[model samples]
Target: MVTKGAMLWLACTYDLDGGTLGHLRWRDEEVRTVILAIPTSTPQCSTSFPDNYRIDCNLASNEVRLGILNPVHGDTYTCSVYLSDATLKGWVLTQVSIIVPVPNVTLTSPVSDTVTVTPGDSQVYTYVTGSCRPPARIDWYKDGVNVTNQTGSVSNDGDEFVTTSSFTLTGAKDDRPATVQCRASNVDGMTPVQSGVKTLVVQCPPEIPTNIQEMENTETTIIVQWTEGFNGGQPQTFVILYRPEGGTKTETVSVIEQQQSTYTKEITGLIPNTRYLLNMYAYNVVGNSSLSSVVDIISKTNQECSYKGEMTSIPNLASIALFITSSVLLVTAVFLVMCIICRRKLRKMRGRENNPVAEAGVNLPLSPVGQHDISTERSHYDDLNLEEREPPSNYECLGSNAAANVNTQASTDDRQMYESLGTRSNAAVYDELEGPASRAHVII
Candidate 1:
């Protein structure tokens, strides 16, 4: 027995223990242990025994603490450790502490915005979750609902989370706006943080035209027009498909790229009052759709059998007709002005040709009349003899028989080939017209 104030270490131990006094039993398939009660009120009982006693197993690793109920220098202590079967107990009683749960969660990336995906395009997103130590698991939702499909989407690949939530639109639903979201979870399911809404918009292909209109009365061909909604991007091409308004698809139809998105279409070989449908589709580089829209064109018949006099018709709408007439007259005046300009140019050209001889005459020197001839009588030959004049330094062709006179320096080949014009003695005259044989001058 240990005294109340006496420090007593493990003074003794017992070899055998049963379930009676805190003898631990595994109760299942595990460790069993035992707890020995060291009494502080009986120090003499403890020290009175021998310091060494045999414990069945080594007890080196056991926590020691002052007894909770007893106040002593070190008379008694309590130990807590793994319950080993060697001692006869199955489990150990360990100390416990209370921990408060953290409620703060952080999300990164995948901002709150709409995701635009063309037809046949897969949408991709990136995000991460945070709390305090253990990371979180992420999940995606569509239209405020959870995604439970395993094969089609939401799979883990080397720590990278991906989804294949593809929505088919063509031949089904046209482009409609949808939403996508992300959810995070931890060990405690109570607190879950959902990311901001991510809007997803899907698209589908376009359909053919319905009703069409025609100009004048034409049965075989009609000008079809339609109103088209805004298609996302400029695609490679738009396919123009057409079929009879109420006829079967087996009938002769048309499909071409040259006839895409044009408001006016020429539908041929159709009977009068027949109906036809037209479809157009525009696509982007990635082949996404929501292409051009379609409309129907209705054909009209050709019928004309009336002739009304313009005099009566013109009188009724004279004011309006005059306004139109004035506009036409203004255009006609502009055309007349252009014609007058062209005629004046032609006349100028004609005048140049007609007066060439007169100009040549003016260039010639006046012939000397006889001084003795008092004959004031005008003669027809008076103007005819007006010839002998100085020739231009640059050669001018007047008469076919006139001799060409060169009057300046020229190449050595000049005098060797042709004789001079002024005289045989004045050979220098012909040399100037030859210019330089080394250099060739182009003549018109």
Candidate 2:
């Protein structure tokens, strides 16, 4: 076998006395008849052939030679010789098989250098080899790795064979922007021709957001932050879903800023001293990713008290003001009541000092009938015992002057006893009543 565009020669020889080389035929066509034939003497003849072919006849050597400048496959040459004895004749034939190296390789299906495809989708790439002999062998490659597992088909268009190879590529996230190429080889020991690189861009949803956490929080607001994941070859946005723990209602917020390594969002309108559950999701044009790991966060408490898993809000300004006003009023009322009581006791003591009849009745010993009357009277004055008492007119005084002196003595003794015991008892009662007023004043 010879390569295309190479020189090839075919010769046929005969050993017959008085024989001459007649003519050469290629593929059942006489070479001299198709082009120009040069007649020569008995020793030699020549022909000019078509398509860069030459024919020579040598009667001395009894050989005929056919010269092909650009040989192609499926070419046949036949030489016929005539002997001097007409009964003997012979012919010789030679067939040509030429190797056609692959000329050009190109991707026909994906004409452009780059193609965009969705993940999990299939893409077909077709590689065609230029017309060649002995049909070229086609191989597929992805990212410089050999993946030539599929068979190829070859068809003859006139004289040369064209090889077509198709490779199906499945789009994947990990293999994004993969480079695919096709190589064609026809001749042994010859380097294969490769098509231009075709880049496969696999577009998919963004990856799940990671490392979600609470950055800061206030009574009604929380600031959340997270590490952004792969955007899947496109711009992506993040969504946050938050809800109070064990609550049925859910709220959502979105972060629309582009191309951030770390994303942050502030969530407002939250309840204080409440536990919240949160999750994040990434979204793109293709689709949304799965929700990220759940995050547990708690909002800060206001002026609140927590007791036994229960929360109570502190009183507001109005309630505090009302409480202070009520305490002040109560303290004033208690002070006024104590002052009225002290003033009434002072008035009764002054009346007892001015009237000697009431003073004498208080110190005088009583008969059974008088004692009963006194007891009945004392019962009506049980709280203060300050009611006016008149001495019995039937009881005789010692004499005017003697009675005056005795009365004076008795008044002195009673005054001494009252000053000793009555003063102490009154002071004790006053102290007991004053304790509450002092405490109320302090509270006010």
Candidate 3:
């Protein structure tokens, strides 16, 4: 395939029509020179190719015989057809080449042709910006003012330039015709050829969760619950902090990203009955957390309180109010029922509900008033107990009182059954305990 001139060693192939049209591509369509030359000079094929390479080409035959030719011979001419010994005509043919234009562009964003963004708030804007060439620069503008954000770098994907522009709102005031226009140009400092603008609807930040509740009393656990996080986009992580009483330093308790709709953390080694400052931050990747809400945890046995807020899923204020009303009624009903059962038990012991803690072993005579008998154990209940009690612990007892009502009806055997259920299964509501002794409940 070596040559004296600048011709490349392009392919050289020959096709004979067998049953279909053969495929052949030639750069220079002009036939240089062809001959119907009969091979009589060589004893056989001097070049070792088929001898029919010279004398076989039929233009009229739908199926014809064809062969290749060697271009190595000198410029002299000796042309003759095979069998007939006639000279073949040497004519030139030309081929034309054409390229089609690209189709119309497609718009991927702003389905309604307008986008609504907030002022001073940053939002990541994305688009499939494509063109004949790479984009020089892609910028998103609003109302002729540049919408700024944390812009990521763009790379060429096929015939498109991909970039995510963070749209920051220094002042995305209410009802403003906020426009998100993605301008894409091929070269830097050039005019944007394909651009789209969408109107933005800017609003205030979502309201923070109300009525934060903290579970304390256990020397090693803290449970925080609130109304569901802002029901806008996906939920964000919860950042919690703990500051001991009388101390200014604070420690981050946890950063919960997934399953942030609810939060419950078991903090070990916390002091019993001591008050700790609690703060909760609800956030997501795209938005900052709502204002930090404060709560004080008081470790106590089965403490409960009502959380304040309207539910997000429900639409009717009346329904929400009705729900709150019903919940209160239910709690009050249980409290009354518990008060009844507790009074009956106290009557059996012939004791007051508010008996002093020091009276555990101070009585003169051991007595039984009814079938319900009060028997004193030989040793103190706290002495042999391995579990640590968070005496003096402070917490928002959201469910404790109601739970006490439910638990009071159950016997010690029932409590054991519930404890087994709580430990065997994952920590769900089943793990929550009731009554004054419930604060001692731990996972293990």
Candidate 4:
């Protein structure tokens, strides 16, 4: 096979005697046109051929040559040799198969070099090649990476072939600004013609805001700041949703400026000593992003009020008053119960001291001596100044006044007993009386 713009030659030979007086003719079957003719009557080649063709006649060698300059594809050339007697001697056929390199490639689908599309959207791009022989092979590429699976078709326009290739582009945010190219090659060792670069702009929703922070706070306001995320190939703004902690009512605020990488918002008219929750997001014409991480903020207490640390719940005035009143009432009730118990114990102790014999459930015998003697003994007991006294021990009651007569005789023993009782402590005397009481008499 030869390439286009090359030369081709067709020759015809005949075996006849000398002075045969024959002529040669060349005809193209594709176009149905005669290209060149040579006659044996003339000494030189024919001058009637096209400027791109030539003819050579040699009667002695019995041959004729038809030379084609810049021959094209899909043409069958016929060289016929005949005598002047209108008798055909011999003929030859030459088929032309020329390879035409692709001239220029163009992207017809997108029209412009830059194409804008949203994420998850499919875009079709078509590359068409100029007319070529042995139809050009079309290939597609994206970001300099070859695309193996592509669709194409070839159509013949007269004598040349035109190839068309289509590529479907689908991508996400990460694949934005992708470059696509189409290449066409028809002949071996020929550089493939490349179409202009087509850029893909994938527009998508912005990413969630990051690095959320609480900058500053006051008694009735709070300041928040955050870093912006990807803008999704367009201008974007930030919005914040804020509310009191555990409150149903919410408020929304947006940044005044657009396309800023960092933003700050100040929220006002908030309650003092109150906790608040905040969330932020970025948005564009496409859509809004997911909510960012939550940021917690607590407003400061008023200057006159005592500071409460980081507590979300705020107690009302009525509740505080009620709590204090309940505590005071509980303390008063406990004190009254203690007073009643002490009074009852004091009354019981006084009764025991007033009538020791009756309290102890024991009977004591009356003194057998005269009333003067009893009075004298009671006087002596009063002189002792003892707060607690033990009952008399080891003395029997006498039936008559005769006990008085023995008083003088037992005077020494009574003196010894009195000394022993004097040695006893008040607690010892009280302990002896508190135990089971026995019937006893005093020695008058």
Candidate 5:
């Protein structure tokens, strides 16, 4: 376009450089001249090329020198040449169309090779332009598909047009990089100018963890484990929900943020010997995911013990029978030990009672009344034998052998004499006999 007060020139020439027609004079019949010129910026009654050009009809060349070209200069130029005469209508005509230049597209904001974005964040993909005539239309494509969440503006600086298109990207989706591009187009009908692909890196939460396992169990707790799928390109944590089976309320446990394949947790504060229901979920920047499948678990029960402090379980019928048998055996062992100890004590007492010293004290022998005198007159009595035997005093002897011996030793005269003695004297004579004869007692 030609601006007011700008110099401009318009010439009607066609492939005639150094040719025969090139040397033709401006008024020659074969030479062409501008028949019409239009500047759309001005009114029809006014000069269309007002002060912007000059018509120099010299002897050799007829040329129009322009001051400046602006948007008003974007008009069709028509030229004509007469074949026979200037007044005749037989002529060859030509036209020239002028327009703005094509645009150069550029990606301004995402200057680096790739742009990172997360879910729920508003990202701006800005497209700008270098100097261009006839401002271009900016279109955005995401993964080869056109996008509409965008805006555009165009401004001209007299010599060139500037265009800017900003695409605000926002949506909920899985984490993945997307290919994005911006292209510019205009009236020049040339190939569309485009910017290189700018990758959109997305981050979001992972899927629910699966394959929950009850690894270990105790009287008051359980050890649970699980496996996790993709992490959605972000770090994640886990939440575990647990409760007694068929109970109304539930308990919650959480795992610290992580991105590993497998995880484990110790779930405590549980009732002993109770059954439980449980599930797990994964958490990331976005939010928690759907709960995983429910699982069943049973807390361990306390173990019982026997009276001897041996560990045991609640007794079944068979176990009761076995316990009774064991009790009987233990009782029998205790009784046998007691009996053996009693027998040992009795044997020791009987041995002490049968000692020879005890028997000697129970049967002590007694001495005769005249045992001292007998010992001193032993030789005299032995020499005098029967004639010198002395009479005993006071007590009567009840020994049969002594009586028999006295009767046998006594003569007829002695018997008559002893019989004449009184009963008292006879008893006194028998009292003195003792020794082995005392064991055989005869009471007269």
Candidate 6:
């Protein structure tokens, strides 16, 4: 069947020697036509036809044409041929019908409006219409709400019209999986056709955690903890950075797949008696957060007191023993050296006490003048010769020069007295002694 407003043409073939009348019938009215003496024809639509219909006829060719055909004209259409000649049949008829089709609606572009976007961002979207005999109207929806902010336009293709709808969307907090749709409709009032549902995903960066602290500490490790912060509406992971204070390089530790509101992490492989600076940050699908303020901490230095492991290795025990032995040896050696030095000084003092005269040397005084050299004279007397002579002992009265006129005389008693005085050879009498060179009296 022909569509509404389409042209309908009908032709009848006949054997004719004379002029004929051709009429087209639609509904209950006839389409009129006139044939002149020539072969040309004039056609007119009947009053029952649509107001915009036009008719044309070819009498010579036995054809009729209907323009702007409408369903209102009728379901059945008959084109008739009437003959003016008696020999021809009275009527020649051909029939057809007209039909108006239902409008088809579809979406051509943006099969689905689902998309991913950063939080607090804006985006542009395009929706196009699929092929439709009659142009379809496009409508936009966001979050299941009809959108009026956008405008649509139509363009012609080979046999159908395409409509495109474009719009801008500003992101919001609730934009995660935000649904968007494009619906098409026509005058038929049938069910509206739509594109598949679309979604806008909103991702965000992680927030900085709060109140970080060193929960536990030791010589070689520390346990860190903190209260969690907002996760930027998404899952997050944490990164911890630590370094020795005033150090140029840093060490890193990571915490992943974390979903809790608080956290604790242990850091190991550190040095004792060292200072450290610690900071932390978090990250998610969007980006990383700002680094937290750094904290200062000092590791314990007293390994023996603070370390948990035992110092039971052979080398350590041996070192302890060696240290004690060395200290004792050093003290003993110092004491021995001091004792030797003191002993040498005491011996030198004793030697000075033992030889005082020898030590005086030539400093002694000489004998006094006019005094006999008593020791030297005593030594000479001991050296005198005393050999083989009988003793004569006597008392004599001498003159002034008695010693000059000496005589040998002795009394028996005097001799006996002399004999009583033991002598190997001697003559002795009472007399005066002499000094070294001058005479002096002596009693004998």
Q: Which model scores highest in TM-score?
A: 2
Q: Is candidate 2 or 6 superior in lDDT?
A: 2
TM-score of 5: 0.43
Cα shift from native, residue 357, model 5 (Å)? 12
Prediction 6 global C-alpha lDDT = 0.56
Stretches off by above 4 angstroms in model 4 are 1-66, 70-72, 77-94, 99-116, 144-151, 189-197, 215-230, 246-272, 302-444
| Order of quality (TM-score) | 2, 4, 6, 5, 1, 3
Deviation from native of the Cα of residue 380 in model 4, angstroms: 68
Q: What order do you get sorting by lDDT, best first?
A: 4, 2, 5, 6, 3, 1
The list of candidate 6 runs beyond 4 A from truth reads 1-117, 133-151, 155-161, 172-179, 187-189, 197-199, 203-206, 227-236, 272-275, 283-287, 298-444
TM-score attained by model 6: 0.44
- Give Cα-based local distance difference scores for all models: 0.40, 0.69, 0.43, 0.70, 0.57, 0.56
Candidate 1: which stretches are off by over 4 Å?
1-19, 22-107, 133-135, 148-175, 203-444
List the candidates' TM-scores in order: 0.30, 0.51, 0.25, 0.48, 0.43, 0.44
State the lDDT of candidate 6 residue by residue for 16-94, as single tens digits.
5555543333222343431212232323333333464555544456554555444343433343444543233434444
RMSD of each: 27.3, 13.2, 36.8, 16.1, 17.3, 19.9
lDDT of 4 by residue, 1-444 (tens): 677777877677677554464566677775443543445344445644467677666656777776778776666888776666867777778888888788999878888888878878889998888998878888788999998533269899778889888889986776648899888898768898888888988888888988888898887888888888877876777888988999999999988446457788888998887899999888888888999878888898754243575545456677899999999999999999999999999966764454343332222222322323442234323222343445445332222342454555454443454445557864554344344322123432
Write model 5 residue lDDT over 1-444, tens digit each, in one string: 322334444454333233222121112122332223222222211223444434433313433222224314344444432222233222232222234444577777768767666667757888887656666777789888987523278777665678888987763456467778887766545676788888777766678898899999877879998998656656787889998987999989988766467889999888777999999888887666788999989987644333476766754466789999999999999999999999999965653343222221111112243323333333222221122222333111213333554443333333343343333342333343332454323222
Error of 2 at 282 (Å): 2.0
**Candidate 3, position 252, lDDT:** 74
Measured on C-alpha atoms, candidate 2 has an lDDT of 0.69
Clashes of each: 33, 0, 32, 0, 18, 9
* Tens-digit lDDT track of model 3 for 186-253: 44454554455666655444335556786544544676666545523434455567777887888775
What TM-score does structure 3 among the candidates reach? 0.25
